[model samples]
Target: MPLYFYSTREPYGEFSNFALYGVKIDGEWWPTTEHYFQAQKFEDAAYRRKIRDAHSPKLAADLGRSRRVPLRPNWESVKDDVMRACVLKKFETHSDLRELLLSTGDEEIVENAPGDYYWGIGKDGSGKNMLGKILEEVRAKLKNAAC
Candidate 1:
């Protein structure tokens, strides 16, 4: 049984603080978090691009008439944003940033991510990957750590 932190809110709600989890992929406990980071990086870039051009001129003027407002990426949004931006160099489990930190408790894992979001493994995740196609972005982020 894999142990991890789980958010208590429902999907689209606030993130959970901590929890425990399990999986059945290839009889493996979890997916991984390597490529997940890359995925997150790309996601953020894409998100910025979206909002940058999405604002209406009227609303933009009302908000700020003479100044540019570069809104910072929200922590929650960045988690998935960074994952989408990274191109796949390699795919592996142990390489996952989340897995490495969770399994080994290494601080270096946080630095490995593109932007530096340090949220670690969850106990009840479905092993989603960064592609956002998968449920675990961190799992896919550790491209080099998997064996």
Candidate 2:
């Protein structure tokens, strides 16, 4: 059966970007993958830092969802790559998370966000689920690297 994940409080919660795993990328520490992913939507360095330093992932998400700061022109095309890098780095930085992800043994991963049709399975299950697909890709990479 597929592994369904969404809320940070649920089973397999670590798989959610909102989970408390921090990742260091480009010499800076992000509080969570959600912060980093959200911050990447903008081109302003200061705005990005604001999102990065936000007290919580929910706040960072709120900042990211704001259209006050225009998004990078290529955000649409580069978002998946950004998420992939963040997820990979998060798992790489945390050994316990790596093991937990690998222990799933190839079960399909799904981000069960009812309102996010792009990165999750929407209410009707017709969403693209890009985040889940990225997690599976990262899982495969980690499995191969253990060889």
Candidate 3:
């Protein structure tokens, strides 16, 4: 089974009823997608800032608005580290994130963005599914740490 989420109130596609942000987990509202995204940003501050700063003002603004960072080519290898950084910051402060992840019970959690080949399993389910894989790994790490 695949766990699903969408940032907005009206969930997208198959997640249409599984909205992420406002859902309650562990008696608390779940953190927004931006919360996770912002936390992940700290994982590679220098690189993210360098790219944003080096770009033209318009591009920089666009990047900020899009919240999309230019990552290292070996991002897949470092993705777990990024997720770990996010989990460390949010696990205690945002219990909802932690509890929700734990509740997945070994199922893959997919972001399900139709066009996001890197972070999502595409509509046809042909994409790399990197983000889902990272989430599972992070969940396992957290579970082990709790042991």
Candidates in order, TM-scores: namely 0.19, 0.99, 0.54
Deviation of model 2 at 23, angstroms: 0.4
Q: Candidate 1 at residue 107, lDDT? A: 24
How well is each residue in 1-147 modelled by candidate 3, as lDDT tens digits? 777654444332222212233322224332332333332333466544543343233343244334355444665576556544443444444466677677778787787768767667677877776666766777787789889
Which residue runs does candidate 1 get wrong by more than 4 Å?
1-71, 87-118, 121-147
lDDT of 2 by residue, 40-61 (tens): 9999999999999999999999
Better of 1 and 2 by TM-score: 2
Ranking by TM-score: 2, 3, 1
Q: Between candidates 1 and 3, name the one with more favorable lDDT.
A: 3
Candidate 1, 1-147: lDDT as tens digits:
222222223331111111111112223222122322322233244543332332332232233222244334563566454433322222232134244333532222111112213333223333331232322343444534455
Q: What is the lDDT of residue 65 in candidate 3?
A: 39
Residue 136 in candidate 1 has what lDDT? Answer: 37
lDDT by candidate, in order shown: 0.29, 0.97, 0.51
Relative to the true structure, candidate 2 reaches a TM of 0.99
